[model samples]
Target: MAVSQHASVRKTVKEDLGAIVEMIQELADFEGMSDGPKLTIQDLLRDGGFDDGVLSNSVPLFHSFVLELTEQIRTGNKGKITSCSSNDEPLTRTTIIGYAICFYSYSTWQGKSFFLEDIYIKPNYRKRGYGELLFKTVAQHALENGCKRLDFHVLAWNPAKYFYNRMGAENLTESEQWEFTVCQGKKWMHLPKTIPSGSKPLKS
Candidate 1:
């Protein structure tokens, strides 16, 4: 399929959650880890504060942006447009082809930073600059929010790492030997209730 010339990026709404979740699965499958994603649309709606198709008054855990293409492209036997009309034209349809989800984080050394949880473009839409557009959108959002850095993890075997390298991203694992670690499953869910020895829990 040819790349759509009317592609644009914008903040994600609640209605986009379904598509986002679908794409998230697509990304996980592409990474050879199809079993990793366990989140649902409700999770995203609550965490991202997109319950009303807009940012909620309460603080949000994350934010997202979607790349949409609005064009007069029709397919199928009856030549029926399957997507919503953008300009009131029956043939014009808007489709979400890519998305990026991110959250703010604090670094002791760098103060504020942004962490990209996921960025995905549909398989058919690859190599058409949509990925770059989504990535740059996330970076720009981070800078606008007073973030000093942007961080994300990419699989070592994935070729997308080269894209990040081209966009001036640093591989801390290679340059600083910083290892990413996580404590989850049973142990994480069942932490000790009492402080060990003389160590007291800090007041919230």
Candidate 2:
């Protein structure tokens, strides 16, 4: 049967913390950004306090229900790791075939917008229409929220550049007059919760 014939996507909630961590690790490895998870299992279990907040803004938004599709077992013949009953159960996807991490934000250029921080589908899953579905879902949400655009970035080495091109996401290169800088981790961690006036760009 065709892959799309069974194409399904569901949302997973926060209670399935282990699965979220595993999928994240799988995604990191598959992207060749890193093979081993940068975060330990413990990080997922306890890094955020019982009252602690969610994923960092720059890290791609993973809210309580971020990974709805795989977590909920709403896609394909596959089901949750916890619910499968067969001894000969098929191997669960060890790589992230498709994902979208996003948030609502105000963009000076596009007014209020839906910023899609990341979307990825494993190489094997390409041409299956899953990626298009993911995009459509996000775009639809943005429209629902009255967003003028849905924005995201793709790295230079990523193979999906051509695919994004067909989707009409133009190549954005650096311009001479203005500069873009990114600050991550260590420094961002130490910054005050609220920045004082005239503070230089601080991440943490």
TM-score of each: 0.84, 0.58
Task: Please give, for residues 67-163, the per-residue lDDT of candidate 2 as tens digits.
Answer: 2323223232444454444653433332234556567788787698887766655556668677877777777777987999876766668777787
How many residue pairs clash per model? 0, 10
| Model 2 pairs whose backbones collide | 8-75, 10-68, 10-69, 11-68, 12-67, 12-68, 97-121, 188-203, 188-204, 189-204
Q: What TM-score does candidate 1 get on C-alpha atoms? A: 0.84
Evaluate residue 93 in candidate 2 and report its C-alpha lDDT on the 0 to 100 scale: 35
Query: Could you tell me the lDDT of residue 64 within candidate 1?
Result: 94
Cα lDDT for residue 168, model 1?
96
**TM-score between model 2 and native:** 0.58
Off by over 4 Å in 1: 1-4, 52-57, 73-90, 197-204
TM-score winner: 1
